[model samples]
Target: MSVLVVGASAAGLTTAEALRRKGFRGALTVLGAEYHPPYDRPPLSKQFLSGDWDEARTRLRPDNLLAALDAEFVLGDPAVSLSDHTVHTAAGRSLTADHVVIATGLQPRRLPGPPLEGVHVLRTLDDAAALRNALAADKRGGVVVVGDGVLGAEIAATVRKLGIAVTLAGPQAALMEAQLGAVVGGLLGELHAAEGVELRLGAAVEQLEGVDGWVSGVRLVGGEVLPADVVVVALGAVPATGWLEGSGLTLENGVVCDEYCRAADGVYAAGDVARWRHEDRLVRLENRTNATEQALCVAANIMGEHQPYRPVPYFWTDQFGTKLQVHGRPSADLTIAEGTIGERFVAHYRDAGRIVGVLGWNAPKQTRTHRMHLISGEGHR
Candidate 1:
């Protein structure tokens, strides 16, 4: 029962580890596009981007731990296509196995503009290093971040800490409104503003302005130009499924899979790339926690445990020295479960009178305790 994982990142690596932990002694191979060993991405926007941590510190696991798994890691060669249980890499390597897992993750969306020098997107380790160098090189220049979601807000916060003037422009009314809701998102907006990040909310970016092939500023739809030396586009990302095109696998927003995380007879998917049926709907989660959790479920099912992949969604973000943790889906209907918005607090999100989400604002201990509310069904209605 040989297994082939087509990504060496968190999801792919976790799947291989879980397989070994579950006593599966089959051939295991982990492939990656990046030459660097599997590294954590969440830090790319904060610690890695700000140079607080070096590249080695961002690695998910040390060399000794990875060696214990005893899996063949094919790095720097990306999977270009998949035919049945065999995957063809760009390096002209054909790898076949009894089971193939797709955990290719996502590719960041870029803005439609000139290929300017200072325009950037944060996705991989290389992208982070490039952006970090650009930010550090420009001592007197400001940055214009063109997204209001979690990634954009985090980048702006991280860049501002470097003493670089940051202008956060986005179509959303508040920062992370789509994920954290308007009220809490607005509170986050205030936090950014208080920390000297200029907010340009409710504005559409028309295009990028450049001089001599270098980004000079960002032009909004209404002809307002936000001057900047560097522009970071954090619009969002789509699943990396271009390689799976015509692979006979259903690809919508991601690799479509069943409740068992199986896309076909011998093919499975996990992490950001796998959009599987959850209850009545198909859902794809893009967080690190979901990546590991879904991979474990996939590995167990492959080992014949046959368990369904059902998990309470969880994600956390740290910005400006404040840590925000969210459990379940955040919504517009929120109640102050503990403390006040000005200080540490936990908020419950309700939908149709049922508590559907929990959010902790700098209150990790209380947040963990309140998370049981969702698990124990104590706040269902």
Candidate 2:
């Protein structure tokens, strides 16, 4: 039997590797759109952009490990269309496989702004490299980040470390107010401010002004302009599901899948592209941990070992010399801080008297304990 997997990122590579490890000896093919091999993305905004790690050092698997899978790799060619049993690539190649895995993750959401030379987005290795080079070229210029999301925050922090004046502007009153809440968001804003990043919270970009065909500054809705030599638009990413339009799978925000990540018979999807059945709702998680975990489950189910793919949603972010990790569901109301809220602490989020989430600020060991509570609760459900 032949198995075909589209996308060669964390989800795609992990699913293909898991299939081989789980004893799938049939023909396997992995298709990727990028010219480079699959690499870790979390570091793109951190160490890679900071020049602490090189491109070759970011590969997910070594050459020897990838060779063990013995799968045919079609790099730099994306699967443009898919039928029930057939996959068509942009390079004029049609592949028919016994089973098809759709792991196409996400694409950066482009903003409706002026096209300037210095305006960039971070979603690929090439993107990080370009932004990094731009920052290094003008070490003293101001960098305006258009989004206050985690990616934008990280980029702002890292760029600040490179001696560039960074202006982080977003519509929210605080950075990542939806995910971190007011308390944590305030703390993070303080951290960024302490690091010399100019915060333009509650500010909306009206238009991007350019100087000589290159981005020069960002004009706010109130006619205030933040001088900038470069602009990083980290608005967010959308599920890369445009290619699956003609496919028979249900696409509601993401590929609607069952609890097993199965979109249809003999077909499956994992990662940010798959919004599987969650507790009382369908949710799509776009984190690295979920990608690996869900892909393994997809691999298992593809080999006839059926198991529900319900994850307790975990995510982490590193910014301004502080690392924060979160597990479980977060609600608007968190009762109190289970631990201290200083350099190290575990904030407990409760919903209706039950702890729904645990957030750790530099406390890994303590955070793991509360994370187990979530794991046990999930197992019982």
Best by lDDT: 1
Local accuracy by lDDT, each model: 0.94, 0.88
- Name the runs in model 2 displaced over 4 angstroms: 378-381
Q: Each candidate: RMSD to true structure? A: 1.1, 1.5
The sequence of per-residue lDDT tens digits that candidate 2 reaches over residues 38-114 is 89999999999999999998999988888888998889998899988898989999988999999989999866855
- Tens digits of per-residue lDDT for model 1 on 1-381? 999999989999999999999999989999999999999999999999999999999999999999999999999999999999999999999999999999999999999855998999999999999999999885456899999998999999999999999999999998899999998999999999999999999998999999999889999999999998899999999999999998999999999999999999989999999999998999999999999999999999999999999899999999999999999988889999999995899999998888889999999999999999888875542
RMSD of 2: 1.5
Angstrom error at residue 292, model 1: 0.6
TM-score of candidate 1 on Cα atoms, chains taken together: 0.98
Model 2 clash pairs are none
**Structure candidate 1, residue pairs in collision:** none
Residue 252's lDDT within candidate 2 is 93
TM-score of each: 0.98, 0.97
